[model samples]
Target: MKMNMFGLFNKKKSDTVSLPYTTDIHSHIIPGIDDGSPDVEHSVALVKQMQEWGVKRIITTPHVTEETFENTPETITAAYNLLKEALGEDAPEIIFSAEYRMDENFLKHVKNDILIPLPGNHILIENSFLQPFWDLKGLIYQLQLKGFNPILAHPERYAYYYDEKEIYTDIYNSGCMFQLNWLSLAGYYGKETRNIAYWLIEKGYVDFLGTDLHNRRHARAITEFLQTKEYRKLVEKLNLKNDTLK
Candidate 1:
């Protein structure tokens, strides 16, 4: 397996490695709901490829942004059902969830008690790419107050927080868990994100590692990344909670 400058992989299907854990907590596999898989065929293909890489269970998280995705429970479940019907019994166990952007829609869902959580009542939340949300600490408090365990999604991708590394510690200290995008360590997002990922690992702040699998391009990068010496070294020292999801 080989990786290119664009972070895509050139490899055969046989060039695979077992994932560190079976359950992928962050992925966008629900068909047509977001920017992940465009249709059921694509969703099936991604899942099959993931199974080949030894992911036995997947908690597929589609985007739930206000203006962009606007994924309600009804829409998400509909897409999930369609994908499951297409896959039949020849795939990994898949659970439907949402990677919620901390926006008004999310707050509304929280108030209405309409959010879908992971197996352990864990909710994956994302911040805006351009800036951290104005009241992230308040939002985390609200989620916790409502009995939801919040897991911040892909902190390394937030460029605004890069210079203020102490804020990462503050969020973790606020009782919110952190989930690092595994591909970030593979330089899939770029050198800066990869550096932040390693920094989070060194800080003992990353509680989970997720694929955040969007499409085939991401899958290829991750598959090739899993076979690298860097991946082996990183996993050896870090204590990840991915397997505990089941």
Candidate 2:
């Protein structure tokens, strides 16, 4: 269980810094459930890496898309239990929820009240990348009516809303909180996504910061970015709610 021997943690203590927030609200570390870790071994490695990076608790959110992941509570729980068993006492505190796509399937879950939420009843949701969801505001209102706090996951990655930036404000005003992907700030997606990430920070629209980590490549990029001056500055400017989730 010597997690420090893995990844960037092997660097000199002065050369590396722990994440500001102890609770990581978004990640894909659950094994074999979605596009995250492929199995229990990979999940253990990823969790150990996060532990070295100062993550005390992980709220691993697997994708619950309609046609793609189609994850159910039973499936997610089984995978989560497997991961926990593999890690034993060496693992960081782990909880399981799902990143729900805003679609008919999710609406059905809402109707059935089967959706898993983060601490404080906050639910992470995403929009279709190909196009904006119609009546997204209404959907947010519906979630709110059902007593769930809906947080739009990685708003910067949605290219359709780039030109119509006013929609961002509209969505915020409609009471949907925004979660910014930490990798987006590292320019992992591209220049446009980085720009929007900063833009959200400047406008004070970003309420939560998530790793959105999918693999080892993402872990390396995020680890490198964490030590940069830009990352330091960005965190100072952000009023993130990640700690509140604990």
Candidate 3:
């Protein structure tokens, strides 16, 4: 597949260009695996775009819900292989993991081999959009007991926690890392999530930044984000965007 530059490989970005935080351990870029890239061509394109943004490695995380994605290790591996075949040897290092939803049956997945672990012992977790789990703390503790460090993806967007400012700190203190969606900082999830992303970053609570690149829509938000001076400056100033892999 031929690569087109959507400012992906263009490194002559302004001093305002914020580098990526780290390898995106959460994304739906795997074709048909989740709601991300539609097929092989689109997946390859997304990968090229990530490369242009200076992402050295990308762990494509397709969703694995008991009812929805249901992406087992075998299914995800097949998607990885297909993506590689499309990109050829020149493709970036593409790894496979999953974004697992924390549900009533989540504990069973933790016990079974159905769930995939994020790189470096991290487990990407998502909760409901309406309300947080009643046993949220216990669930996280269960994940910890299983020897996996759970990462709460897009913590700011959860509606229930918007009023409770300390929810972020409380969860983080419970041994979970926070992954902020790049679009949230750019107001993609609306003004509330955007403000929360900034708030968390300011408070030194956001450990990682994720593109959460679901599709072309998300791609557009990231493009806009890169053009901003603060976005570029924060990554370098705090050393949060580009230095975590070391």
lDDT of 2 by residue, 60-114 (tens): 8999998999999999999999999988987788998899998989889999999
The candidate with the higher TM-score, 2 or 3, is 2
Give the residue spans of candidate 2 off by over 4 A: 1-14
lDDT of 3 at 94: 76
For 138-235, candidate 3 gives per-residue lDDT tens digits of: 88898788787788888988978878988778888988878888888888879888888788888887777788897767776787788887676766
Error of 2 at 82 (Å): 0.6
lDDT of 1 at 240: 87
Global Cα lDDT for candidate 2: 0.88
Pairs in steric clash, model 1: none
- Predicted structure 1, TM vs. truth: 0.94
After aligning candidate 1 to the native by TM-score, how far in Å is the CA of 172 from where it should be? Answer: 0.3
Tens-digit lDDT string for candidate 1 (1-246): 642322233555577887888888999988898999888877888888778778889998999998999999899989999999999988678988889999888889999999999988999999989877889999999989888899999999999999999999999999999999978999998999999999999999999988888888898888878888988887797888998975
TM-score, per-candidate, Cα-based: 0.94, 0.94, 0.88
The lDDT for every candidate, in the order shown, is 0.88, 0.88, 0.75
